[model samples]
Target: MFRIFVIAVLPLFFVFSSEIFTFLSGALCPSCNCESAKPLHRIPRPQLRPEFLALENGTDARLGCEDVGYKMHVFSREPLVVYFENFVSAREREHLLDISEKIYTPSTITHNGGQTSDRNTKVRDSEVALVPRTEGVRCIERRAREVQGWREEVWIERLRVQRYNPGGHYSHHFDWSSGRGGWGRVSSFMVWVHGEELEGGGTEFPRLELRGDKKKWCKFIECEDNLDGEDSKDKGVETAEDKKGAVFKVIPGNAVYWENFRSDGTGRGYNETWHAGLPVKKGVKVGLNIWSYGRID
Candidate 1:
């Protein structure tokens, strides 16, 4: 009786197992057609989009500063003013002037009493044009950030191109604002973009005094000539014999960088950073002001 039961159960198991195997095989390879049961190969991956391919290949094409070199001379340490020779390339200067030729408008100063206003003022008599962020302009901005020892480009404000004609000047003022809230300018880079045989237009820091070699500074500053005795007392003129500070001449491709904030925790404006752009007495002077702020905004 036990052998008979085993035979019956074995046949039923074989028949059921065959049916299960056949069902699974059909589910997995429905299109096998029974001619071959070979494993299916993976479908070829879709080709990457053209934009994606371009992005993958662009990492090696970025610009570098390997060919750029510049000279720096310390003008003052208290307010941290440094003069840079050949800060901007000749081509960059020409490009800036060409792009901004028709965009110049009367320049405005920060409102008195720490208010915000865009009205034109006599305090700043030059015309200004904001240089758009083109590739050339971006290169100059990056160079400026490197010179300042800053790693981030966002700290820089928009580049300002200023045109000063005869008698045009900016009265003595501090670059950093005295009010609270948003960050004020921490430093400034003023570049002389164009000036040939330019006279009288110079950046004067009345509160800063330098005892360095006069001849050496002559290359970067106007150390040879003193302000005319009569002009020294003029209300608009801040630098005179009685009031002595370092004054940098307007030399093409050269720039003066000065720190506007104190080192203290308060981050207040440094008194020695007070400066003015003297009247342009001769040829036209075109300058670029690159201001770096404490905050990115």
Candidate 2:
């Protein structure tokens, strides 16, 4: 009876073992996420109010609209700890501009593809905008305090203002530095004090590489100079006020924002952002930039 039972069970055991072996040996498999790669459809531009971009629906929603692309506001879980205010009185605006002008003092200048510290660049004087945070003005410090969980010695790290002149452009470039000892910035921000209607000069973010795609590049086109050899000053991204400009008028009085984060939680922040400033074809284009460094000590 025992021999007969063994004979009956052996066939069933062998059959089960074969099935398990096949699965373990990769005889059957499922698809992966990397099979195909394509660029994501552009996000729709968000509606603009007097100064601030409407934050209804979602913070990830688009804000400014342009011919090439739209501007996005990126914050953590809550609404932006950082804010853009064009509501300041004329007197207050002048005061802030004055403070920036007073703190600027050029320590170095780099031509061509040469480089300099953001600290050094912040010191230069330009007719457009000023970026200063030395003994007196610590805007970056004040801003860092506003962000939750960002308690640390507020280091201006590096501050700079771009005095975009007619025909002058920073060209297509990424804000992240490639130096041996880089800024190691965890977050970065910029505020455009004045708006420009100058054609041929608008910010653009090219489609990003997703899935299995390998190419990732963005370009800023300084719209071709006008027939007069000056900026046609076509409207820059539309704002909520319904005002626009041509040439070098800064009437739009708005701000733009972007972060270097990917959708799937892979590469986020500085590593993935590629940007540039289009050539200024008419009047001066001024902008203030703030770079935040991760704690070093």
Candidate 3:
């Protein structure tokens, strides 16, 4: 009996010792014997410095961000589309506008066999300006980086501010046409910097299917673009949201984020993400894009 008891206790002791060794080594999870995981997909964190300056024009902003009330409203699960409220602070928006002066030229398009076209074309029309990195600019970058959940091989592109005057538009297009050397755009964030007094410039993803409270969603989406009684706000209603698509309203301080690639770990451009910047028909609208990439390596 004593020998049997010793044998049973020995196995238990060895198992407990192995777990303690694994924990102390800090190389693998003690319980699962797998690699320790790092945190990702964090919330945005804005720069709170009392004074921030723009690197491009030396324009300064006098404000601090103790906290950001930016809220994410999910619109899709497969391709991961989200709408953010209060994504940009008022002071940062002003700084972006100040730096854009004299910097914008007639926008052009590059498609099909290296050909280029001016903003008057039927597909796309908007003046684009690259945002120089400043403290204020970095504030936005930090937020995007946090929200995007950085990886070792992935990096964010420099911000590009786009100005769409009345009649400006961009037809359906993919942000990641193809991966270059195994790298490609994986996510996109479109931030509305300044667009008050503007109308008819909504971002639309014609392939997405959206459904929610009509009254709440209309404030953020172009709900009136296409709606029928079949797609009622009431529950248990047989709806046809797939045909209606998703159109985001042009709201100041708000933004839209979505995955540009397939979610199946392929890093391929998602066909369902084909989106368009609807024509601006009434007033000028200024927005910014934060694009991130993924690598196959």
For every candidate, C-alpha RMSD to the true structure in Å: 25.9, 16.8, 13.6
Model 1 weakest lDDT span, ten residues long: 51-60
Question: What is the overall TM-score of model 1 with all chains considered together?
Answer: 0.69
Instruction: Sort every candidate by TM-score, greatest first.
Output: 3, 1, 2
TM-score comparison, 1 vs 2, better candidate: 1
Per-residue lDDT of model 3, residues 80-111, tens digit only: 88889998888888988888766887667755
Clash pairs of candidate 3? none
Per-prediction TM-score: 0.69, 0.43, 0.69
**Higher-scoring candidate on TM-score, 2 or 3:** 3
Residue 145 error for model 1, in Å?
1.2
Model 3: how far residue 143 lies from native, Å: 0.3
- What candidate 2 gets wrong by more than 4 Å, as runs, is 1-92, 100-136, 139-141, 148-155, 178-183, 196-200, 208-253, 260-272, 295-297
lDDT of 2 by residue, 124-236 (tens): 32343334433222433343234425444323334455555565554444543322222233345554544456544444333322211111111121123234444344534
